[model samples]
Target: MINISEIANEKIKEMLAAEETPNLFLRIGVKEGGCSGFSYGMGFDDEQHEDDKVIEYSGLKVVVDSDSLKYLNGLEIDFKESAMGGGFTINNPNASATCGCGSSFRTATEAGNPAADPC
Candidate 1:
């Protein structure tokens, strides 16, 4: 399971509303790539697969596929606005190592590639 901070909830609602889709769900997952071996993937989705897990936070709907659930469990998502810009940050307790870019990460037991460099 994951937790969305109030700031993230507000920003996500605004983005979803702009999409103009009445039933859009925020889909988050991990895919192979990046320096850390795994990268985060997030976007608006309209359909949920059979193995997807759905959670309702505030008024936003979130969907995470089973394969990514283990990696994302206990994650806390927050939105922050700084002089530079506004962005979403993920605090993933499950990640043993994360890349400098922040979006890429790896757990001790599940590194994505045999040849991927250590984080």
Candidate 2:
């Protein structure tokens, strides 16, 4: 299961409300190639695939593809405020190691494909 913290939920809702496009839902996924071999993808999407798993949180809809479900299971999302600014943060239980930027990770059983570029 995926968890979205209260702060993150509120921030997401605000962003959704500000969007010009309608019927947008949050989409989260894992993709190959990063400093740690795997990278995360999150954005607003209006399209839904046959293999998508939809999860609802306080009237918010989130979609996850079948291929990324395994890597994102038990994932936790949160947002924090700072003097500079605030951004969403991820706490992934499936990740054995994460890159310095915290945008890439590697699981205990899988290393995925690391990119040549630096994080």
Candidate 3:
């Protein structure tokens, strides 16, 4: 299952409030690209597919597709504020290797094709 920290929950709620759509749901998935072959993707979605898995945390809605769930299951998302700024951080137990920027990762079982050279 995917988990969101208290800090992230608050941040997500704030973000959703700023959106034009009142019923926006946080969607998390993985796509083929980045240095590590797979990159995490998150955005506000108002639509859901038949195979989507939906859950709620701190009253916020989250959805993940079946395919992406394999890579995102047991994922923990947190929010952090520092001198640079504020950002969301993902701690994924299923990732065998992650890129320098921490947005891309590869699993032990499959390393999908990268869009370009490693960054």
* Among all candidates shown, the one with the greatest TM-score: 2
lDDT of 3 by residue, 1-119 (tens): 99899999999999999988877899999998878878999999999999999998979999999999889989999999999999999999998888889999888765444443346
Which regions of candidate 2 fall more than 4 Å away from where they truly are?
111-119
Evaluate all candidate structures by whole-model CA lDDT and list the values in order: 0.88, 0.91, 0.89
Estimated TM-score for each candidate? 0.91, 0.92, 0.91
Query: What clash pairs does model 2 have?
Result: none
Instruction: State the lDDT at 43 in candidate 1.
Output: 90
- Top candidate, metric lDDT: 2
Instruction: Name every residue pair that clashes in candidate 1.
Output: none
lDDT, candidate 1, 1-119, per-residue tens: 89999999999889988986778989999998888878999899999899999999987999999999988989999998999998999999988888887988888876545645555
* Candidates ranked by lDDT: 2, 3, 1
Q: How would you encode candidate 2's per-residue C-alpha lDDT over 22-109 as one tens digit per residue?
A: 9999999999888887899999999999999999999889999999999999999999899999999999999988888889888877
Worst 10 residues of 2 by lDDT: 110-119
Total clashing pairs for each candidate: 0, 0, 0
